[model samples]
Target: MKKIILFPILLIISFYSIQNHATAVTKSREAYEKTGNVIWEIKTKEKLVAITFDDGPHPVFTPQILEILAKYNAKATFFVAGNKAERFPEVLRRVVKEGHEVGNHTYSHLITSKITAVKLKEELNRTDNIIQMITGTKPTLYRPVAGIYNDVIINTAIKNGKFVILWSWDQDPRDWRNPPANQITRYVTKGINPGDIIVLHDWHGSEFSQACQTVMALDDILSYLSSKGYKPVTVSEMLYRSKTNYPEPFYPFR
Candidate 1:
């Protein structure tokens, strides 16, 4: 008799808990929808662009990219995968130490569609914690894995105080596929525009050699930006500049 009574009570508690969670998610989604939190690119008249790298802090390739950036005195944002960053905390620290910005790229590079809302939040929080513990700073920028996102993903990020960052559609060179260095350079140089966010990769799976191409292309890309009199800055820096330099949001959908 006690077990039967306890079972119904437990069921009631579970139902209420689920309902509360659903209500919270719904409220978050509706609230954020009123004022969008997604940023694709920024608009400005000045020759400034934010170049960002995803899936990085690779033990080998990351150092090479940093060296190239240092050579040009350019700053870029690195959206680091938490698992990789945890393994290479030193490399991540170097990225910040060298005056670059870091963003959260999820704990295990999880696909949004494949995970539950709770799981997604867990991933973001875990990555945030890992980054904070290692660098003493929690990332406020988040670029979802494979750039896949939805209402749940956006709301979850905003609830955690992260802005969903995406690159300009034309600025992606797909460097992870290991294209020729010159080709990658040409694609970036030709497509770059003021306030554009360029996306590149600094880490590729086990094959370290695959990421070398991006490092090679980065050297020339930076040189080209210099010749064009364009300044490369971090995403946060670009956003800050937009507030003062150009007061218009450059979202493509708008």
Candidate 2:
């Protein structure tokens, strides 16, 4: 009787341990694949770098950034959050009017890896709808929140007929941390190469101060890129002007 009772208890414990271990292992695998599967940069011989701003349409900073871009006659791509765009439709309109490209950054900025396929589709579609409603243009490019994604996220995006974009050059400068403007400028301009997709943030959550630093840094970075004979273009333009047949939809499903 004791042996029978012990056998059942041991079985239960073993099953629980196995389940926990599997969950941990699965999460680790997802992280590895997420970083590995993304496109870091487009391979081309053109002197063009696509500057992409994410999580934006900030009422204050976005307009200022646009002015700076205009002063230099440069174009960029904004990966805007749907909710933010809806809240500030005028800013969205200005972005379109200024000739910059817009891409979807989801509706609520939820981390895509933690969400289900159905939830991912909803997030993307909701944002795409808002962007279309405001700009009258459907965005073909999608950048995942926090730059996190899994197989489900990628597959769902492709199924929805959108291309997933990740930056080739991070140019982070920890601007979200509100670093000094010169540091941010240096981080972007230093060692910048052709066909590099640089990522910057125009909106840092609810705070406008961080965006101020980004604005301050923008002129210097743009000046340096211009001095280097690099033309800043939208991601699509960079790909097209390179005269190379860059792969679309990234890796196709098998």
| Candidate with maximal lDDT | 1
List candidate 1 stretches off by more than 4 Å.
1-36, 207-211, 244-254
Model 2 stretches astray by more than 4 angstroms: 1-38, 205-211, 246-254
Provide the lDDT at 245 for model 1. 35
Q: In candidate 2, what are the lDDT values of residues 1-254, reduced to their tens digit? A: 99999999999999977754442112343353354333556667878898889898998889999999999999899999999999999999999888888999999888535566778889898999999999888888888887776666777787887767778645556676667889889888877988898888899658444447888999999999999899898887776666645333211110
Model 1: per-residue lDDT, tens digit, 209-249? 54478988999999999999999988888887777432232
Model 1 clashing residue pairs (backbone): none
Question: What is residue 185's positional error in candidate 1, in angstroms?
Answer: 1.0
Candidate number with greatest TM-score:
1
Q: Which ten residues in a row have the lowest lDDT in candidate 2?
A: 245-254
